[model samples]
Target chain A: MTYCVGIRTNEATIMISDSRTSAGVDNISSYSKMWRYGIPGERQFVICSAGNLATTQAVIAAIERDIKNTAETSLLTVADMHQAAEYIGKVSVAVQEKAGGGAVFEATFLLAGEILGSLSGLYMIYAQGNYIASSRQVPYLQIGEIKYGKPILDRVIQESTTIDRAIVCGLISMDATLKSNLTVGPPIELYILQHGSLTLGRYRSFGEDDEYMRDLRKLWNKAMESAVDAMPRLTLS
Target chain B: MTYCVGIRTNEATIMISDSRTSAGVDNISSYSKMWRYGIPGERQFVICSAGNLATTQAVIAAIERDIKNTAETSLLTVADMHQAAEYIGKVSVAVQEKAGGGAVFEATFLLAGEILGSLSGLYMIYAQGNYIASSRQVPYLQIGEIKYGKPILDRVIQESTTIDRAIVCGLISMDATLKSNLTVGPPIELYILQHGSLTLGRYRSFGEDDEYMRDLRKLWNKAMESAVDAMPRLTLS
Candidate 1:
């Protein structure tokens, strides 16, 4: 299981993903799920994957190969973010089909990035090769074990949210997921594309014991406890 | 789909459940999931249902029939809380089997109650006739549409938690689930059994527009928003 979320705010786009991947309880391992691709200052795409490790790796390799070969319809050559997403979807489908039939070969992805003059975009590509872009009413997309982390995003994220707030909200959402589920654990990887900056604006990874991670957890916990205290009591009449 | 949770604290035990039932998105209706049974002042149990609605109704009817017929293993005749749970599990399995074989006939339950002299118990009965009791380390059991409501329960409820806190936490948890999922909705039913009373301490049902429910949602959302503001900034260096 995995948890990756992409938040598109008016000022920036952010994507965050957990690193833990487990085939089973005993087969747990840490693998970064975020793959960065682009030519600096020209275009940038951050692809976050959740599903069979082999399938995601194959899909990423295929994308890298396309870029390297200067394929007619690669991420670098796509006209806009939609086409880039569609190309990834095509690569994903081809890879899964070649791997043969089974849910085991299934994978999903969140693609977030920008091209020089086009509007920044965030999209979720499904295992079936279809994709959907985020809308102004709900400016986020998630893939993987998403439920535990979703309430915060539902409450706090929207088109008008600031980039910094979006980044923090994404982190808190991931923290809620990691706390409630063992399948998703640290280190967490995040990519930020600040408005107007063509290339990735900031990227950071935090391990389980990282100071910032610790502080975030502590602060969030305290705030939740206080929130609970502040809630209206269940009065029975 | 349904969402129900049982929390056992030192002073009392509480069960909360959403009322939404749906065969599909278009077929949605309200039906209480919490069923209370016991001889007041002697014994009491609250069973919360999830999964096939037909199967749950059948199971409840069977329990009622057994009690009315003075069956040797009925809830009124069970020797202890564990036996009562086992009785419910047996009844559930029997009900599912009688409805013929299909996933649609399977049901799960959270049973919370206490006998005259036994310690209060919280049990989760699986569809397979097996049940597990909640432990002091984790004194809550949830069934159906559980993930969206889990983080708050994980963060707040414990054996040492006050009953009021547990009740509020359970309500907030339900609210979170209802907010993130369309399949789980109001009116929410809650039952409370305070320690040694051997009778229900309180029972309340809140509709979507219920004033208390409205206030709870308003306060919780405000708290969460403030929490996001109090979180540490994601300082990039």
Candidate 2:
């Protein structure tokens, strides 16, 4: 299991992913779920993967292969984010098809980035190879184990949210997911792409012992404790 | 779909259940998911239901029929809380079995209460007619749309948590679930039974416009906004 989220604010596009992949309770391993590909200052794409590890790995491998092969319709050559989504979706479906159907080989992705001239956008590419973009009204899309991390996003994210605040919300959202499920863990990968900046932007990874992660947890816990203590006492009226 | 959670603090057993029921998106309605059966001062039980509404309704109906009939094995006559769970679990499986096998008629329950001579306890009765008690380590069980509401419980609940705090956490947990899913909503029912008291302690229902609910949401949202703001800023180190 995995958890990933892509939030597109007016200021930037932030993508967050947890690295822990578990085949079962006893066999857990860390694998980076976020992949970035592009020619700097030209266009950039960050793909976050979830679901069957092999399937996601295969789809990602196929994407990297296309870029290396200089295929006619790779991420590098795709005209727009929509075309990139279509190409990735087709690759995902083809990979799953080649695996042959027996058990579930499904994978899901949240694709976020921009073309040279267009604005940054977020798309969720489904296991079925279809995709949908985030609108201004709903400026985020999440894949994999989404629910535990979703309420915070629903509460805090909006069109006008600043880039720093949006990234903080994304990190907290990932924290909630990690706290609730052992299958999802760190070091969490977070990528931020500011509006109009086609470069990779700031990329950070948070491991278990990382100071920022620990400090954020402490601060949130203190906030929760204070919030719980200060609420109007229930009178049972 | 519904969201129900039961938390057993040393001070009290708190149960919260949303009122939404739906066969499909267009056919959603409100239904009370919490039911109480007791001999007042002698013993008490609160059964929170999830899954097939008809099956839960039938199981409750059958239990009520038995109590009214003054049967030898009614909830009023069950020797202990475990017997009560067994009785309810058997009834649930029987109700589902009676509905035939082509479709799913399963229901799950969280049973919490105390008998006159025993300590207060919490039990989660499975649809297959089995049950397990909440321990000091776990202290809570949730059913239905559980993930969105689970992180708060995991973060805030403990053996020493106060009844007021538990109830607040439960309300906030339900709020998160409600915010994330349309299938779960108001008015939410909350029941708290204190230890050694074979009677319902506090019972409250929160509707869409309930003032306390509104205030709590406001307070929590403010808390989250501030928590986000106060956290250590990302340095991308």
Best by TM-score: 1
lDDT of model 1 at residue A73? 83
lDDT of 1 by residue, A117-141 (tens): 7978999999889999999999999
Residue A174 local lDDT, model 2: 90
Q: What fnat does each of the candidate structures reach?
A: 0.79, 0.72
**Which candidate gets the maximum lDDT versus the true structure?**
1
DockQ for each of the predicted structures, in order?
0.78, 0.71
Q: CA shift at B60, candidate 1, in angstroms?
A: 0.6
Off by over 4 Å in 1: none
Q: Write down the worst ten-residue block by lDDT for model 2 chain B.
A: B99-108
- Residue B38's lDDT within candidate 1 is 76
